[model samples]
Target: MRVKVDADKCEGHNRCCALAPELFDVDDYGTATALNDGNVPPELEEKAKLAVQNCPEYAIEFVKD
Candidate 1:
């Protein structure tokens, strides 16, 4: 699985970063971006999913690889 962040939809809540820092990063303005181009390592899959679930803006999403 892979992760994707919709910058336009993101309200910079940082929930994705808070829940899965390994999968996301937040800018100084609090905009979130997926780490490593949103590639999810096998071990980090659950964390990635958790990040998506926790994003109040629903900006984080999972993509099939």
Candidate 2:
């Protein structure tokens, strides 16, 4: 599975980064960004999904391949 973060929708909450720092990172403004070029590691997919679910602004999404 792949993950996508809509920077436009993000409110710099940092929840995604907090949930999976290995998979996500926060930009200078604190918006969540993918650390792996949008590729979600199989082991971290659940955490990534949780990040997506926990995003208050609905900024994260999973794109299944």
Top model number, TM-score: 1
Across 1-65, the per-residue lDDT of candidate 1 in tens digits comes to 89999999999988888888898999999999999999999999999989989888888888877
> What would the per-residue lDDT of candidate 2 be over residues 1-65, giving only the tens digit for each residue?
88889989999999988898888888798877887688976898789889989999999998866
Q: What overall lDDT goes with each candidate model?
A: 0.91, 0.87
After the best TM-score superposition of candidate 1, give how far the Cα of residue 64 lies from its true spot, in angstroms: 2.0
Models 1 onward score TM values of: 0.94, 0.91
Top lDDT prediction, candidate number:
1
Cα lDDT of candidate 2 equals 0.87
